[model samples]
Target chain A: MTAIHTGELVDRIGEAVLADPAVVRLDGGPFQTIATYLPGRRVVGVTAADRITVSVVLRLDQPIPAVAAALRERVRRVAGDLPIDVHVNDLESKEEPV
Target chain B: MVTTNSQNDLRDAVPAARQSPAPARLADENGQGKTTIASNVVQKIAGMAAREVSGVHAMGGGMSRAFGAIKERIPGAGTSSTAGVSVEVGEKQAAIDLDMIVEYGASIADLARAVRRNVITAVERMTGLEVIEVNISVEDVHLPDDNGGDEAPEKSRVE
Candidate 1:
């Protein structure tokens, strides 16, 4: 469960999610997702005191609400015992030339 | 209205639309100038792994640009000098202004917080510098792609 190694859970989750074209396609859409997780995380001192790493970006593009709702639903339908956090933000465009 | 370049005519002028803004040199006589440091730090940290946030758009708004141009036009105004960027420095604490462009749909507060956190993390880890604050100015919000959010990673649970 949550106590398992992060790598193992990441592998399991990645494999499971990548195995499905429908789920993988969810990475598209008009929204963005920032998910974090930690295995063997028992609570060190405060929060994130364990070993948690987030995904690159199930990067989406829509507004905050719709994106958050969809990611929450999709994640629940996709994984088991794997703790994932999805942060959806309606930020300005980062594609501009720097 | 006197129509000068027709849209079709303008479209035909593509061979002349080459934009090559000369690489602006960053020169500062002052030690650890705010603008120079902020630009370098922001660009570098954004390229790092821990940030994961979005990107930096611009430093301030139109006023900053106007002032920048004014400085550039004035004598010793330090235009073209990233050092012209404001800074608050002490024996051990420091803060700088940052220009940034975030991806559409990313949270402003969250992105700022992430930038602050990541920048501070980077500064601490790299320079042993304590970043007390980072003032971020978001310039614009881009249009979402028609296929917008569905182009990246997809997370779902399946055996």
Candidate 2:
């Protein structure tokens, strides 16, 4: 199978992860600062490895473990059989304004 | 690599593409040119949609609303409709995170549901980008008496 371009692969993985209703976003988190120092390292939380690692923030309403597991499968489909690292860095509130 | 039971479970959790279809990328190709929707565009759209919902008193949390309020006071700094809205826009899909303050007495569950539906509809219709999720964060509540400008006046000084 032809390997996808790194950027393209990243985009695809992002799409897959976001496709889930429970996913909030790929949280910028602390890695946001690295982009400033490392100009081209904009795709934070995504690492190019033999397998990839993905870290994200999720909506609080769903079960965290289940969401993380689902993400692994999603990431694998887009990036090939890569072992993804899913981190639940933050949780968005499920309740409305009180 | 050593795989654990949880990893195996995760492996099984990936749904089939047909079952959970990926969002279609927004494409404008006429063999002449193409158009793209910027992330900011989606952000603004989401913000507007949330604002359109009646129970939404304001966008952003306390500090952000404070800053947004201050920004509005400046001559050229028009109110930022996108203040509380953040988006992660992709080739075919976009995800939105909103921090909002609701008017008191509104049901949180019902309002969130309405806001999510409205935001998804508005963003998808306008941008042609499928909104995968709209995460709402109810940062604060806006009480009727909380309007700083509507405070009862003190005894007339001139009197």
**TM-score: which candidate is best?**
2
- Give the chain B TM-score for each candidate: 0.44, 0.70
TM-score of 1: 0.31
lDDT for each candidate structure: 0.39, 0.66
**Candidate 2 per-residue lDDT over residues B24-127, each given as its tens digit:** 32321211112234465566668878999998998999887888789777743434666888899775678999999999899999999999999998877655
TM-score of 2: 0.46
What is every candidate's C-alpha DockQ against the true complex, given to 2 decimals?
Answer: 0.01, 0.03
Using lDDT as the measure, the top candidate is 2
Best-performing candidate as measured by DockQ: 2
B16, model 2: CA deviation in Å? 13
Tens digits of per-residue lDDT for model 1, A1-98: 34454445445444444343322221211222223235443221111112221222222122222333343344435443222333211122245211
Residue-by-residue lDDT tens digits, candidate 1, B120-142: 66544432335677776666554
Off by over 4 Å in 1: A1-98, B1-53, B72-85, B99-101, B137-139, B142-159
